[model samples]
Structure formats: structure tokens, C-alpha cells
Target: MGIIRTTVFTGLLTTSTAAAYLAARNPVISPLAATDPIWTSSVFKRHNPSRNPATQDVCIRRIPLDKIRPELLQREGDLALEFCRGVWSGWGFAVQRKYLDLKYRGPETAKQLWTNEELAQSTYDRGTCIADHFEVVEKTPTAITVRCGDSPRKQDPRPSDGLFVISATVDKQREEVELRLKTCLFSSEGTIQGIKGPMPAWMEEMHQWYARIWSETGSWRLLK
Candidate 1:
């Protein structure tokens, strides 16, 4: 059988790209800062050797972090905040907190061990919790690291290392942010052979563009 023709959908995910400064941080004050044009414009294909019909399909969405509603941001931060708040509450301290810190001793996933239902609910209710600036920069995605701003120096227990770093700017606070975004749609599932491969012309053109862009746009940032 030829590569199964999967019904895929693509759309604009979120905000656009832009630069801004902290409105509150005046001239005399120091300013803290940080911060895809794909699909529809381009086509990506799976390159595998299996000839069987593919099993799974994927949808690609570019979630512009900048445009996400404040309510949405708050909701996303809930679980993270609760994890941190829980740590403080257990010690009988109930002051306002802005960040969450989590760790696991043995070999296990960080999210699985850190998550708790009550903590999640508490974090959402507070809505006051916001991740620090440093958090965003460290979390942005990179092709090399997958997770943006992730320092290669640190080690992770997650066996498969395939996460994308997504970051966005919000408000005038110059709060840099990073998120490891994932979707079931990005994966190439089912019969490997049935998966269509990149067109020869597109592959050749992409390599040429990559080289040109890297040379012109990525002087200090070497892309491989």
C-alpha cells in the first residue's frame, strides 16, 4: 500500500513576534528582558522506510504566546504555582509567592511526581502566582535543546529527549518566558513505509535556505 493520506489540519496558533521594554522600569531603572512561520507557508513530511499505511495523524498549530489571554496564562501557571505554594504551606507559611520549584530524587518523571489535584486547584484559584523572569528565558525552545532556554549542563530523567521550546512576551513587564509545548499531532505514527517522505525539490530548497539564513541571520548562533 502507498503512504496513507492522512487528513491533517494547520492553523495560526497564537501571537506574533515583537520586541518591547518594561514600562515600569524607567530610564533611570534597569530593564530586564527576554523572549514559527511554518505550515500553510511550507510543507513538512515524514521520512521513514516502512511501506505500510500510516496509523496516526498530526495537526500543527503555532500558538503565539504573546496573544494568549491573561486568563489562559494564569490557568497554565496554576499547577506550577501550587507545587511551590504547597512547599511553603506545609511549613505553616502562607505568604504570597510567585514561583514553583520541583524536584525528584529517584529516576522518574518530574511532572508525574510533582503534580497533585489539590495543589493544581489551589494554584488556579490564587491566580496571583506568576513565574519569575528567569524562568521564561531558561524555558524557550531551541532545535538543539528542544526545550527553549534549557541549559545542556543540566540533566533530565525523561528518557526520550524530544520537546520543543516555545516562548512569548506578555505586557510591558518584559517578562521573558519559556514553555515545553507538545501535541499529539507532531508525531509520525503507524506504518513507517506508508508515511510520505519530503519531496526532493523541497528538501533541496530547504537545505539551501537553511544555509543562507544561517549565514545571514545566525552569525553567532551556529545551527546544524
Candidate 2:
């Protein structure tokens, strides 16, 4: 009787442990996920003189994990990294060869990780716009944030002190994800000193176009 009871107890313990492991590995879906892609933008705001004018654009899309290719899902970071790569390539930005390779600083299975300690830079629009470096500032199983520093347009009279931040989040339960891009234009001097003239209409239009492209097709292109 003692031997039978011990075996039964061991079996129950093993089953319970397996159930807990599975639950921990697979997170539940988030409530914020939507049925369709949603895009939104905010007017530029300056919180400080040293900081640049901040503008935010967000795109949220529903992507069922079961629908995605199994191979791509296994990669984990591929979706977010691919989206970043696509955006730069689509915008005509070329990352310098020296910064092309990224070395992540954290464990492979870490929910949050950082990359590009060497500071990768990219140039766009015939060297008119230069981004100093790319850094993975935040990461998690469901979210990631990429930041671009020392970005500025050649046309701007002030020095290049602006930056851009791009973030992506996944909601498994809702079967959706969200991508947000925020651009900040800063000046060495105070915000008052930074202003030379009104922003050109063409520049504003170009930014709007880029936002639209990322929201509509660029974010999901890799999955296809």
C-alpha cells in the first residue's frame, strides 16, 4: 500500500509541474489588441529646451500567431527586427557596414534584451538626414523598443541633436500587435533658440507619408 501511494503521489506531482510549465511559457493575450489596424498621431511638443520637438505616431494591427508561419514565430525577435529593418530600407536609409551586425547583450531567452552596443548609424535622402546610431532600449516577450540617436536633417541650421524611437508590442490573446514611432528634433541651444522658421510643408507631408506606409503595409510585410 505504501509503495502504491508513493507512485500515485509522484505521478500527480509530475503532472502538476508540467501544467505549470506550459502555463508559464505561454502568456495569455492582452485586452488591448484590436480586430483591425489602428493608426494615430500627435502634434509635436517640446518638453524642454535641450530636448527636441516630440511627435508620436502609432499603428496597431491584429496578427494571429497561429496564422503566422511556424518558422518565423520560433525566431522570437525576428518580427520586431524585421520591421525595423524594413522601415529603414523603405525610407531609403543605409546603415553603415560597421554597424550592420548587432550583438545582443542579454541572454537569448530573456524577455527583455538590448542590442547594438556599438551604435549603428544610417543615412537617408542622399545624406540629407543622418541617424547616429540604433539601440534596443527596451524588449520583452510582447514588446520591443528601438531608438535612433543623433538624427538631424542637413538643411537644419542647428547642430544634429535629434532622435527617433520605434516600439512594437504583441498581444497574444487578442492576436494583435502595435508599432509606434516617435521623432524628436532637438537643438543644442534652448527651444526658443532652436527655431529658425516654420517647418516646410513638404517636410511635414513626407513624414505623414512615411507614417502611412508603415501602418498600412510595412509592419506586416515580413510575416507575409
| TM-score per model over all chains | 0.19, 0.43
Alpha-carbon runs more than 4 Å astray in model 2: 1-49, 91-160, 193-202, 215-217
Model 2 whole-model lDDT (C-alpha atoms) = 0.39
Writing each residue's lDDT as its tens digit, candidate 2 over 160-189 gives 343344445566777755555544443433
Model 2: weakest 10-residue lDDT segment is 36-45
- Highest lDDT against the true fold, candidate: 2
Local distance difference test values of all predictions, in order = 0.23, 0.39
lDDT of 1: 0.23
- Could you give me the TM-score of model 1 versus the true structure? 0.19
Q: Model 2 has how many clashing residue pairs?
A: 3
